[model samples]
Every structure is written in structure tokens, then in C-alpha cells.
Target: MSAGEQHGGRVTIRQVAVHAGVSEAAVSYALNGRPGVSEQTRARVLAAARELGWAPNIAARSLGTARANAVGMVLVRPPRVMVVDSFFTQMLSGVEAELNRAEVALVLHLVDAFEQTIDVYRRWYAGRAVDGVILTDLRHDDPRPAALRDIGLPGALIGGGPDDFDLCGLSSVDADVAGTARGILGYLRALRHRDVARVAGPADLLHTAQRDAAYAAAADDLGDLRYRVVHTNYSAADGMRATRELLSTAGPPTALVFDNDVMAAAALRVAHEMGLAVPADFSVVAWDDSDLCQITVPEITAMVQTPALQAELTARALLRALAGGEPTHVVLPAGTLTARGSTRPPKRLG
Candidate 1:
């Protein structure tokens, strides 16, 4: 029988090497596009492999090398929510850029809940599907770090405390959410907004809780600041509904702050429908600076967190963890405050 027929129509690297009259190593180098093979030898190997219909065994190759050469990112949110958020998009862009330079691949897995994220990680680890994993949006007493530690898995965390948890020798990047809150509050105080309303994200979220605590602490010293906090689901519709409720109160706030730009834009629309001019009758500030900030009639003043920068930093951290480095914590500096048309001195209360 011919070599192809003998191998059940499958082409082996040995057959390709024999056909090209080259070593198996040379065939491998040529097929993998490595530099060791000469141009003529590479051409011959390619021609032989093509003729024999040789296909590389990915699983066998991975097992032999013991390297997946890919990083996995587990995001604790729905895919739709992740897709709509500019922060995630820019962060992913940064991650892709860094990984591209290293010739590594990024695998993003979006899960709706913490349990689901954990389940996916377990499967990936058991299957050896990734070289490393990345964790984001950490909560109080998070179970992920501990679970990874027990399994001796390599990982990196974003927005969580390193000292509190056993991170399985993984690296971490922390954003100072409390400090971010203080800065935003300071900005509003500078704008002379004593009566302010904050539309916040889910309280269970670590960042949201930190911001809430910071706002409370900061508002304490500002005598008569009269701050009100409203919890929402980080949606535009929720923001609109919260703003409407706040506006209907006996003494509505002269300024509003939203945890996300999506809700902030919704607040703008709500103000318009209520016949209140932006930065005139009321002012607004958004936490994340994104395209949504500029879409409104009056652009939103916001904290500009470079998602791409965050993503790149996170990627590097993951790579370091994969290289057998001890877990390290990196707290990036706070983002810049961009002043736009959405904020100003409050209107006089008659």
C-alpha cells in the first residue's frame, strides 16, 4: 500500500521528512515556520507535507512541549455587558497588543456570576487549556484566589488586595477605587456642589463598596454637603429612573455623579426631558470616560481611566506569573480628570 493509504489517509511528519529527503527535525522546523530550516529545504518539506496532507497534532504537540502558549482571562460579567463597556474593550485592546508582541494568544471567557467563573476555571485547569488565567472585579472574601492557590494554578488579579488572599503565587494589579472616589468628591466640592446625588453600582461589587465608603468618609467633613447615595444596576435605564426619583424629592441635588458613563448619559437625557439645562440647572460627573460621555448634548466631565493601559499592565503581570515569579501587587496611579460641559458651579437655590 502507498504511504497515504497505509496511514489511513493521514500524513505523518516522518513521511514528509522521507519524501523531502530531509531530517524529521528539518520538517518540523519548516512546518512550524521556525528559522532553523534552509529556504530550499523548507520549500521541499512544505511541498511534501502538502502532497501527503500532513496536519500537525495540536494536542500531542502541546503535551510534548508542556506549554499552551495562551493566557485566559475570566471576566465576571455577561458578554453583552462586557461588549458594551468601553473600559473592557480598551483593556482587551491593550492585552491583545502586549500578547501579540510576545506571540501569545489571549482567550476571553465571560461568565455571568462568580460561581460560573469558578466552574470555567476549574474546567480549563483540568483540561490544561491555558498557560495562565486573569481575574478581575474582586469582591470581599473572594473565593477565586484561594481556590487557585489550592490547585497551584498561575493567575493574575485586577482590583483586589494581595495581602488578604493567597493568590497562588499570582501577580495582581490594583486600582485605588477609594482614592478615585475621594478625587471625584473633591472635584465636586471644588465646583461648590454641596447637595450632591450619587448613582452607584451594585453594592456587592468591591469597587462599588469602596466608593460608597469613601464618599461617606469624605462627605462627613464637608458640613452641610448633604450627599445622597442611590444604588443601581449600572444601566442607563436604571440611571434615568434613579435620577427621576431624586429629582422628584423635596430638595433635589444640584449635581449628580454616576459610577459609569452609560448611566451618566442617561441622566443627561433625563435632565433634558425635565427641561433642566446641563451645568446650568444641574451638573454631572461620570466615573469612566468613554464615548458615551461625549454623545450627550453636553459632554460629561469624567475620570479618564485608560482601559488599554490597565489591560497591558494586567497582561504583563500574567506573563510574569507564568514565568514562575512570586505574586506581586501593582497599584497604578489614578486616572486624569477630564473637564467637559457636563459640570459647573451649581445654580442658586431660591
Candidate 2:
């Protein structure tokens, strides 16, 4: 016998069968822990295995189980840039927490482009590399959910709209974007600001569309309040550029609202460079309040979006979806507004 076969004493199923006084097939069933073998036969097989010091091949056992014991996550952007966003980080932390409790591992894949994201999902589903998937950064007409549905794989969306595309009733968790926008507008209107300017994120995002629509509806309801909307790429640099352009206009708005804290902080810096005072000269309010809110000179008053809570809910929804439950739509209420020094009654124009 070869060294590889001899070291363990060539303890094959036939040998176990002879030692246990059972047929080879019965020994095989018992050794594999299959249900066909009687209890007495199984115990005899185990005793023979112990005497021979034989062990089942781990690789073969795993193949028999046919389970990866891991969940996949696909981020629709560059990993480095996505990690910088506190919202993503917090949400991921929440996912990790839940996954840890379940003793499962998270397999994260970052696709730099949209096409790449689609390809990654396709391959993952075909390969059966994960038990389920988590989809993030939903666009207006996302294809991942459909692909997952076609493949008969379980998945959950982190952000999506009610009427937006879904893959055969896949579960989705949406942030209260409309309510968030309305809350911000209500706060500004309550402060007696008649004109408000908004720096919005990418128009392709469903949340951005929802926010924009809500803001427009609120402004119309207020009666006589002027509204200006500027769409940007949700980056600090874009926010700074938009703020500069908006402030330099012929009739600059008295108050500015940003869709994210990164842009809001950039707007604060722009205000400082232009020698404009916060609140006294202009009021500002930011959505998705994060650490950046407190870092600026005049702390920004912002609408808080709890990423941790979103993540927890998303994890639970995904688990339920994986278990073949009906699709669930959870709409968490909008976060409370944290009042800071960045907003006040608009100043009198000269």
C-alpha cells in the first residue's frame, strides 16, 4: 500500500463492514451518518472506525453538505470610497453583528461599476458560492433583484422604492426618504424661511428622486416659498462647487439644504471662504446627519438617518427572505431633527 493509504491503516468501508459484521452498503450509510442504517449498525460502524483510527474526509463531507455557510454582499461602488461613507460603514457593522450572532460569515464583493456589479451577481448565483445575498445602492431600474429572482436565489435590497422594480416580490427595506425631506422642509418653513435651495445627490438614485419629489410637494403646499434644486454626485468636491455656483447667482438663496453631511460640510467651508456667516447671513440644514455635522465651525443642524437601525432591519429581512417567507416591506419612520447652530431665521436682504 502507498504511504498515503498506509499511514491511516487503509481503513476502508469494506474493512469497517467486516469489523462491524454488516454489509458494505450498510457500513457506508452508517459511516456517512445517513438515516438508512439502524442504530445498532451505526454504533458498530462507529466503534470500528474508532478502532481503525479512521476519519471522514472533510472536503468530501463539505461537498456532501452542499452549503457554503456564508452570505454575499455586493456594493455597487468602489470599496475605498464606499467605506468612507459613515452610513455604509455603520450599516455594514450592523450586518456583521447579526451575522456573528448567527455564526455565519459575510462575503463582500465590491464592484467599481454597474456592469461589473451585474456580472458579479450572475457568477455568484450560478456558482452557489453563498447562501443568500444583500443588495445595496439601488438605482431607479435595478437589474440585480430580477436576476436573483430568475436564478431562484434569495436576496434583500437595502434601499428601494415601493413601486420600483422588484424581482418577483423580493424583500426590500427603504429609508423614510419622503418623510425625511418633509421633516427638513417643515423645520425650515417653521423658521419663517420663504426661499430654500437644495443640493441633491445623483438623480438616478431612487431615494434622491423621492426626496426631490417630497421637497417640491412641500414647497408647493407652503404657498409662495421659492425652491431651487441642484443635483450633484454626492461628493464633497461637487458639493463645494454647487454651493459656490448657487451662492454666486444673481439672487442667491437665503437658506441652503444639502442631501448629505459631506456636501453640507463642504457648503460650510464654502460659506467661510466667501465671508458669509452661518444662520445670521444664511441658514443651512443637512440630511443624513453624521459626524461631519459636529465638525464644522457652526455645527450643522441635520435630519438624522440611523444607519445602524437600517442595517439591523435589513439583516432580519434578508434572513426571513432566505427562509422562503413572503416579501416584506419595512418603512422605518424618519429620524428626528438634531438642532444645531447651522440654521436660524433668514436675514433681511439689503
* Overall lDDT per candidate, in order of appearance: 0.78, 0.78
What residue pairs clash in candidate 1, if any at all? none
Among these predictions, the greatest TM-score belongs to 1
lDDT of each residue in 161-241, candidate 2, tens digit only? 646355466677778777777788888888888888999998988778778888898888778788999999888888899
- The residue-level lDDT of candidate 1 at 341 comes to 95
lDDT of 1 by residue, 9-94 (tens): 65667777888899988887777654687889999999887777676673236325556677898877653463357777777788
TM-score of 1: 0.83
TM-score of each candidate structure, all chains considered together: 0.83, 0.81
RMSD of 1: 3.9
Query: For model 1, what is the alpha-carbon lDDT of residue 14?
Result: 74
Considering only N, C-alpha and C atoms within 3 Å, which residue pairs clash in candidate 2?
none
